[model samples]
Target: MAQVYLSLGSNIDRERHIRAGLDALAREFGNLSVSRVFESEAVGFDGDNFYNLVVGLHTDLPVGQLAARLREIEDANGRVRGGAKFSARTLDIDVLTYDDLVGEFDGVKLPRGEIVKNAFVLQPLAELAPQHRHPLTGKTFAKMWDDYDKDRQKLWPVHFPWP
Candidate 1:
């Protein structure tokens, strides 16, 4: 089984949308490890602040199949296409990485350059995979996450019992 990490976010009905999305992902994947939800301002979007977190999933699904599943989970949560860049979303799921198997599709690369760029992703990811090393840069998730800049944005830990 490939250990996959995904970033999940929702600005519309923030918590509810996220909860629903989590439920959907759980139903589909079975084994899900969710990160503490972090509330942060919309980075590029201009609608509402979002509740974001990273989820670690263990599955045997291929990268393409996993991506399709992630997109479907987001779509089921009210995400609309063709909107402005970084628009507030009901559910946004991005495949951060698939167990170091890096490849490109639709012009985007797995572990996509954003893995090291966004704290919303790295923080929770570090929590999930402290010892897990990156495929390209070879840095452990915890190290990269701890080293990222968290200047203006704040990450509030979600303390609920995990799903």
Candidate 2:
């Protein structure tokens, strides 16, 4: 099974959306390691605070199929398509990485550049895969967490339970 990492977030009814997304993922992958919940300001565009978390899962599904499943989960949680990429949503799930494979995803790219530059992504990624190295940069999540500092000014712990 490929070890895949997923980042989950929402600003619209953030807690509920995040919880639903986590349940969907648990059913899809059977098992997963989820990171602590964090509250971060909207990445782009203006919106309410986003409750975000990252998950590490082991599954045999191909990257494309996995990405599709993530999108489905978001849709199930009331997400709409065709908005400004960062517009407010009920759910947003992004595939950050799939094992060591890295390439331009026909549908959704793995390890999207934003994952590396964003602390919300990095912090949970470090929690789940501290030792896994980035495909292009060859730096472990923990190491990168130490080296990089994105706009963390707005990121705060929600202390919301992880599933």
Candidate 3:
């Protein structure tokens, strides 16, 4: 089984969607290593704050199939398509990385660019897989986070309990 990391976020009915998303992930993947949920102002758009977190799992499915499954979960939770690039989302999930593979596969970019650009994605990822090195950069997630400019964005952990 290949190790996969995923980023999940929600703004509309934040708590409900996040919980549902996590539940779906657990049901589909069997087990999940999840990080603390952080609340942060929406980036790249004007909207309600979002609750974001990262999850790690082991899956035997191919990258394309995994991406498709995640999209299904998001859609089931009311995710809309063909909207503005960044907008209010009931549920959003992206494939962050698939093992140590580099470049794009099955149209999903490995080591997603947002991993380095977005605090919501990187922070939880760093916390969950601090020692896992980036497939391309070869730097540990913890190291990249340490070097990240925390001032670029503001995010804080909230009380998010999961089963």
Whole-model lDDT per candidate: 0.81, 0.83, 0.95
Q: Give candidate 2's root-mean-square deviation (CA, Å).
A: 1.4
lDDT (tens digit, per residue) of candidate 2 on 99-147: 8877776677667787777888888888778998998899998899888
Write the residue-wise lDDT of candidate 3 on 1-163 in tens digits: 9999999999999999999999999999999999999999999999999999999999999999999999999999999999999999999999999999988899988879999999999999999999999988999999999999999999999998997
Residue 44, candidate 3: C-alpha displacement in angstroms: 0.5
Give the candidates in order of TM-score, highest first. Answer: 3, 2, 1
Write out the backbone clash pairs for model 1.
Answer: none
Clashing pairs in 2: 96-111
Instruction: Give the C-alpha miss distance for residue 8 in model 1, angstroms.
Output: 0.4
Best by TM-score: 3
Model 2 residue 78 distance off true place after TM-score fit, in angstroms: 0.6
- Against the true structure, candidate 3 reaches a TM-score of 0.99
Better of 2 and 3 by lDDT: 3
**lDDT of candidate 2?**
0.83
The TM-scores, one per candidate, come to: 0.91, 0.94, 0.99
Regions more than 4 Å wrong, model 1 = 105-108, 159-162
